[model samples]
Target: MQLMHKGSALVTDQDIGENPSVIEHAKRMGLRLITFGPHCNAQVREMGFHNGNLQIGMGSLRLGISLQSDGHHMALNAQAALAALHALGYAPAQVQASLAHWQPMIGAGQPQLLPSGICLLDHSLSNHLLSMTAAFSQLQSVAPHVSRRLIVLAGIQPGQASIDAAQLALEPLVRDAQARRVLLYGEPLRPLAAALGDLLHVNWYDDLNQLICSLLRTTHKGDTVLLAGRATTNLALAADAIRDSFSGHGGHLIASIQAPCFDPHQKQMNMHS
Candidate 1:
């Protein structure tokens, strides 16, 4: 609201509840409102994506913009950018062409290939479940050759009303990713680790440094690591630690550890001590 001025345009998606309120507020302030999404009534609408490209159909005008990043969320974010551009009176063709050069910054689902051949998807900047799901989807698309996928979850806020419901919601995401082992860090995620229980191989960690070092020492080549957390958790530090490990002596140390991180007979590794 602070960003808006007289004759300015408000651009947003249909999912935001602030839309109607913002529209009324815009009208009072003489601000133009523009919305774009799957089910929004606006000048720009009909937005969707396939593979890594975003498609927007505004009436008879169609624009297909290639995304430099991964996931469904990126497509929506790009569509919102396009809508914002539309509100700003930019040509659709110009916006489409310009967006081709856009790339996601670190910690926003950007895939990083360490020198040790571990593909790390750092999504620690975000805490939402939807974003985590998108990160898993990204893994399926980008690292098909990954022999083992290890999830280094800083935390997860399920937002569900009950433990069973939250477990039901989270179970499939882990299973679908085919994660060989799950390493969870921080106190906020104890319920998350508990929810997974014995159904999936899960390890709980209180010491962030230990978790980082353990994964570094155990994970091998052809392994993909998905790091998910929020800013408050300082999960980005963990991502950095993993990246730094490979560039230094830690890389040599990982090569010497056993091939797989988990024992075939063990379902969970408790590192609370």
Candidate 2:
């Protein structure tokens, strides 16, 4: 199954959470620095393309040339991006992670105007899909339709920024998705069940029992659903959900992709190490 989350490049084949070559690729991409919050930590604040913590938290920032985020700390490890920017011979741009604590940065008041290779801004991790939906909407207009969307989460508390981002991202898709195409995330919503009910129509399931019930009611094969974002890996439970309900009706689970970088060949191959 294809991975569906964003910023998979930051995570590596080893799963140790650090990719030595990440920065090298970032540099080749001509990455500068992009700040999200204000000048919080000097080291992190003015760093290069590598980064995160937008939501409490981040899914990372969607730059004018590349990027997309409202957050789930999608790409926090910045060393790779840093190396990349430097290698490109570009003085990384500056990003403002928290403007609420803003100060004179890169010798400029507005980050967008900072002529450095990097740019910074305190993104509103206040909404999940705000970045992704916007990016997807734009991509749909330019690229071929993949019928797949990604969900990237973070290691933050619900109160941090995940809630805001989730509401911003998932709700609209759920509301707009055509019937069987909607794929409710497999992980439990924790204390979020009430919020889940707000989205309209489409089959919504919290677990296998609900998934089967929804299918028994209406669904079909060739239809698509996305299991996006970060959560405790629950493949067994997800398998159970599908297995317990596989027998009912006209539909079949065609794809169960999790998260793949937007352009893995391009994104991952950037590793210089």
Candidate 3:
């Protein structure tokens, strides 16, 4: 693809697999090419969680990238961008400053904090297994001490394969987070209830209203609730209902939804004020 900057144009491969064609084309055009690979010279020195943000130490420059998840690809993308910037004479300090304001797109890696002290991680936009697993691992580290750890999984569609995959992805989070109660909704999640049988409190509901009712009744103060799964109309409705139920309860309700980064949809979480 062509990148235009200051009357100069640069071309690069779309992915690592297309490097051969990109290199050949560059050679034919007498143009210089800069490439990055899986095992590139630039590397991430260390990565950790600090104050709900990801701290990445790269080649003597430390940058804090904000997100609720691990962001496995994001680190690599940053490395490539830094390499390009370095070639263009940008200092490592300048690059670090630019990344200070880098925010994750909504439903991708954005994390929202409700007034009730609940943190919502929205990964509904892209739930690739690896990404989801990374996100949960980060969550496990930053999760605060609370009375109960609750997980709500919405419905998946297109058949049993998707359901099975989601279950496998979530099992580790359930185990690691020590989720005390899990609420499963929709037909696709029926099988999951049996799979997790007797491990913890598993409540299966065919109707969203029933699930919300159970959640409202069972949840107590200082509980951390995580809502994940496919975004459906019913799931949205249920999320709203649960958020409303926490209005005057003086507790947190974390809800994840699918939306673009700039989408302007906001609702009240607490009404006791």
Higher-TM-score candidate of 1 and 3? 1
RMSD of 2: 19.6
- Could you tell me the lDDT of residue 130 within candidate 3? 58
TM-score attained by model 1: 0.74
Candidate 3 local lDDT, 134-204, one digit each (tens):
55554555465534566676643434465566555555565666666777776666666666665646667
Give the residue spans of candidate 1 off by over 4 A.
Answer: 1-6, 14-31, 39-42, 46-48, 141-147, 157-172, 247-273
The digit string of per-residue lDDT tens for model 1 on 1-273 reads: 566688877777765624567667777888776777777464566567777777788878887888787776677777788888887778888878767777888899878888878788899886666777888887777667545788887755556555335434555787677677788777666666766776446777766655766777667787888888766777787787778776555555445433434445423346332
What is the Cα-based lDDT of residue 8 in candidate 1? Answer: 79
User: After superposing candidate 2, which stretches have Cα over 4 Å from the reference?
Assistant: 1-169, 177-200, 209-221, 233-273
Q: Is candidate 1 or candidate 3 better by lDDT?
A: 1
Please report, as a residue range, the 10-residue window in candidate 3 with the lowest summed lDDT: 264-273
The order of the candidates by TM-score, greatest first, is 1, 3, 2
What digit string (tens of lDDT, one per residue) describes model 2 on residues 178-224? Answer: 23233343333332223444433323334443343443233223222
- Please report how far candidate 1 places residue 172 from its true position, in Å: 5.3
RMSD of each: 5.6, 19.6, 9.4
Give the candidate number with the greatest TM-score: 1
In candidate 1, residue 19 scores what lDDT? 56
Report lDDT per candidate: 0.71, 0.31, 0.54
Q: Mind sharing the TM-score for model 3? A: 0.59
